[model samples]
Target chain A: MILDGKALSNQLDVNMKAEVAELKATGLSPKLVVIIVGHDPASQIYVHNKHRKAIKLGIESIIERREADFTEAELLQLIDQYNCDDSVHGILVQLPLPKHIDEGKIIRAIDVHKDVDGFSPESVGKLFNNSHEHYPVSCTPKGIMTMLSHYHIDPKGQHAVIVGDSNIVGRPMGALLLNAGATVTYTHILTENLSAHTKTADILIVATGVAHLIKAADIKPGATVIDVGMDRDENGKLVGDVDYDHAKDVAGAITPVPGGVGPMTITTLMQQTIELAKVADHRTLQPVR
Target chain B: MILDGKALSNQLDVNMKAEVAELKATGLSPKLVVIIVGHDPASQIYVHNKHRKAIKLGIESIIERREADFTEAELLQLIDQYNCDDSVHGILVQLPLPKHIDEGKIIRAIDVHKDVDGFSPESVGKLFNNSHEHYPVSCTPKGIMTMLSHYHIDPKGQHAVIVGDSNIVGRPMGALLLNAGATVTYTHILTENLSAHTKTADILIVATGVAHLIKAADIKPGATVIDVGMDRDENGKLVGDVDYDHAKDVAGAITPVPGGVGPMTITTLMQQTIELAKVADHRTLQPVR
Candidate 1:
């Protein structure tokens, strides 16, 4: 069965709507500040979608538009402003910012409580320490688990192999899978005999934007596959790192590009927004164990 | 060959003492603050050993003696007092503080910069995130790696099965091994068929304080075993988690309980103290790493 992220996100949106309505009744709507640097077409599309989603969920989202060449000083200035803004419940700066600005610097600049992207070392550290007191998990990966559950993929005791070592997708992905009780292996280019590890994985997640890096032969039969890549293949069409056309035949479950993980990324973001709103309201969304 | 940590720690002090001389040439001595909160005889003995080691190496040592019934406010106040004191390079509040004090609360109070025990959630989180900035690693696992290298027992590409899940030993040990390019399987009480994982490990580190928990029957022949357990067997003799008499006959290398992990634990704290002091001077120490 395919993991329907759009369906999951829709269901999640309804729950968030109720949460936002409750916050509205208290005369304080959840507010989010999204800073997008540059005129990147993809970033524009993302910001627009996020704004629309927040509005539909009764959230107040203020988009702080900045130039592609925004100075580090300017970017941090906006972040400091958001950090102090009582009106801003969450803060996210669109990633892949211009090369001049240290992405980590800006990410860490946001107060730990306000960093919704969860990329700050402080935020990432909390996830590691299991002290996530109001920590916002990365939307894409959190969405991956949500999608996995939607398709009923219980990772417990399974061998989960992630074919990337990126801090964003690979490392945290391994941590998440490990937390779920899966025997996790983080494989990278440095790892000798990559196929030897991949073929044994009960769940295979490929996030290296190297197009067609993972094919049907790289996966175990009846394994679950998650593709978290967006890159162009030889045909110049957006394809995942996986050779999905044939992989679907061998895999028990899979996520498709554009429809699978795409919708859930922002959907998880909005959900975190509502969750953060509840936290700011001095109410607990889930009891701390 | 027993991977003797007592011998290793002694050898390390000789090496680190020479490094400390160089460090003193620059007019700064690696300093450690050993805080004991109770009159626990065992804790007193451990603190005394650490204090003696630090003095022998030309390192500055401060023993902050506090009563068993100290108030939470007073303990936190002591922690805060050290947070500002520049002479204090490392802070170690002895474990198992009196019952009235919440260990978790006290653990959080230690400044992450001076958290030599590396038990603070911040340090643990940073270790988990693979970010090694200004954070002290937990001592015992660092000592385990030191023992591995001193004995030429490199864990790279090997399967490491650690039997225990305590924050002090098993969990961080798994993270440390994985960071060094090993396939680590962390087993706790909930893990089914404990020996199944242990038997496959090329290197096994048994840290569950249960005496004689691991026997020769549970380990693969020629596997390296590092016993972190310091429990007394039924006969009232000190023994490690592994039964040495049976284990030594089969295992390629093992560490004895009395002379194994115990000595290195204090040595690691001293090494980190020197390392942190050098770090403060914009230099890095190469002896341990």
Candidate 2:
């Protein structure tokens, strides 16, 4: 069975649209400010899609675009402006800034309350510790968890292998799985005998950008496979890390490349934006004696 | 081969003691403040041991004893006092606080600069993210990493299985190994066929606190095992999570219950206290024109 993320994302958007209308009725506008520095082509497409989704869901989306030569100080000043604005519920600075800009400093500059991208150290810490609090996580991993829940694929007592050690996806993804009671193994580029580990997984999550890294023989029969890769083949066709055409025959369930994780990530971002807005309003809307 | 954490700790202390003396000569007195709020016998012993170790290393140690009935507000006030003091380099609140006191609040109350115990969310985030910046970590796991490095048991390209899920030990231990380039697996009570996972580990770290939870048959021959449990056996004797009497024979190298991880924990605490003091002083000790 294929995990249809695009269909699920559309279904979720309908509910979110109603949620946004209700929130606005209560005088709370769910607003997100995305600050993108430089004109990286891929990042531009991502920003465009997010803005389109927010408008469709009735959420306020603001894209603050700057030139490639924008100073790090200027970017930080812009972030401070949105951070101090009570109406802005979420603030996200698109990553891979210019060489002159320090990414870590820029990430740390955003207020934790408005950290919708959930790339801040505080959010990462909360996720890893499995803190019993409402904290945002990297959208890709969080969206995968949502898809798993929708499909009733319980990770409890299962051996889940994460094939990548990226801070955004693989590390947080493993932590979420571990918190859900799955025995999670994290393998990276330095890992030895990758196939030996992947074959033992009851659930396999492949996030490495390497094209078709895991073949059909590397998969465990009946395992739930989640491919997070959006790599291009030699012929310039987009594909996942797993050889899905053959691995799908052996795997019990899987997510495809373009229509699977991509839509869900944007959907999760919008969901978190609305959630943060409600939380922010709740603090201010407290009844006084 | 035995991983003699006691010997390595004593060896490390010789160098730390000298380092402390040199800092003191430079008008910087490295000091640690440990606060114990209740009469938990185990916590008392742990606190006493830490104090003794600090004094022996030529570092100033202060013990703040409070009544079991002390209010959480009073405890917070005491932490604030230390947090404001420039003389204090590290603040530690012994765990298992009174039923009325909130542990998370207390942990966060300590200034991150003086968080010697490294329980703050920021430090944990840094550890998980493999941040390049210098940061303290939970003493136990940090101690294990020191032991691994001292013994030349490089974790790179190895499969390391952690058989517990406690925030202090198992979780951070896996993160440390993952940062060291090892493939890390985290297993807990909900893990099915736990032995099946342990058998594949090149480096197995067991900290479940369950007496004799892992036996010789459960281990892989020639695997390096580090047992972090401090459990009492059926006979009321000190033991570890692993059945060391028989399992030691199957393991290629292992750490014993009393002399292994135990000594190293105190050693790492003292090491970090001095390091934090130096870091704190470095920021204030700038040269003027």
Candidate 3:
């Protein structure tokens, strides 16, 4: 069975339109401010999609544009502006900031409460520590969890194997799965025997950016496979890390590239932005201690 | 073979004595401040051992004792004083803090720079994120890693299983093993079919605090087991989570309860304090920007 992220994302977006309107009726409008540096075509497309989704959901959207030569200090200043804005509930700095700016430094500077992207160390820390207070989770993994629940796939007690250990996907995904009561095994570039680990997975998540890295032979029968990779085949067509044609035959369920994890990422971002807005509004209602 | 944490900890203490003296020669002496509230007998013994180890390593030690009824505000105030004091290089709040005082609240209050215990979320975040900057790791996990190296057990490309997910030991232990290039699996109380997960380990670390919870059948043959449990059996004899007598026959190497992870925890705390002091001094030497 194909896990249709696009169909699910569309359904979520439709439901959110009403929720956003209800919030607006109460005079609390959710707002997201996205900062993008350079005209990196890929990042531009991503930023545009985020903006479109926010507008569709009745969210107030603002995009701050900067040249490729934007100084690290200037970007930090822009983030500070959004952090202090009362109307802005969520802030996202599109990645691959010009080489001159330190990405880690920029991420550390964002207020955890306003970090919609969930790339900040504090947000990552909260996710791993199982913090009591609610904080934004990284969109890709958060979306994956939502999809699993939507499909009625419970990860509890399942053997989850994640290929790749990138901070953005593999590492956080491992933490999330472990938190959900799955025994997680992480295989990366340094892993000695990749197949030895993959064949053991009850739920396999691949995000190595290597097209067709996983195949039918590597997957266990009835395993649920989630492909987070967005790569190109020799024919210049989009492909995921898993060989979908073969894996689909063996996998109980699988997500395909382009139409799979892609749409869900933007959808999760829109969802979290509204959640941040609702949380902020709730805080305002509480009498000052 | 028994992995002798006691002998290794003593050797580390000797080396640290000379290291601390070398730093002291530079006129920046290392100091550790331990705060204990309500003197639970177990906490009292642990605090005393820490103070003893600090003095032996040529590091200054200060123990702040508070009554059982110490208010959370008063505890925070005490932490603030130490945070500002230039002489205090490390601050440790012994665990099982009075029920009235929120332990997490007090932990977050400690400055990360002085958090030798590594209970703060920031320290933990740095560990999992593999941050380049220096930060203290939770002592028990740090000690286990050191023990692994001393025994020449490289976890790289190995399957490491951790049988606990507590914030202090199990979670950080998994992060450390994963960072060391191991495909790590985490099993906790919530884990179903626990033995199924345990039997696949190349290197197993058990810290579940359940006496004799793991038996020979649960261990993979020739696996290196690091038991972190300190539980008393029916006869009131100290034992570990692993049934050592039975496990030693099947396991390639293992640690005994009394002389294993227990001593190394305090030893790592002392070592980290000295390291923290050196890092602070290096920062001071940097030319003013």
Candidate closest to the true structure, highest lDDT? 2
- Return the DockQ of model 2: 0.80
Candidate closer to the true structure by lDDT (higher is better), 2 or 3? 2
Please, what are the lDDT tens digits per residue for candidate 1 over residues A29-120?
A: 88899999998898899999999999998899899999888899999888998889887889999878999998767777888777777777
Candidate 1 local lDDT, residue A57: 88
State each model's C-alpha RMSD to the native: 3.2, 3.4, 3.2
Over B132-194, each residue of candidate 1 has an lDDT whose tens digit, in order, gives: 466678899989988898888877778778887667887788778877877666666655567
Better of 1 and 3 by DockQ: 3
Better of 1 and 3 by lDDT: 3
What lDDT score is found at residue B81 in candidate 3?
A: 98
Could you arrange the candidates by lDDT from highest to lowest? 2, 3, 1
**In angstroms, how far off is A67's CA in candidate 3?**
1.9
Residues A17-128 of candidate 3: C-alpha lDDT, one tens digit per residue: 9988988998999999999999999999999999988998899999998999999999999999888998999999999888999998998888888989878776777778
Cα lDDT over the full model 3 = 0.89
Per-residue C-alpha lDDT of model 3 across residues B1-289, encoded as one tens digit per residue: 8999999999999999998898888797999999999969989999999999998889999999999999999999999999999888999999989899999899989998899987777777777787776778899999999999899999998989999998899999998888888988888887788898899899999999899999999999999999999999999999999999999999998999989998999999998888778776773332100
Ranking by DockQ: 2, 3, 1
Off by over 4 Å in 3: A283-289, B283-289
Who wins the TM-score comparison? 2
TM-score (C-alpha, index-matched) for candidate 3: 0.95
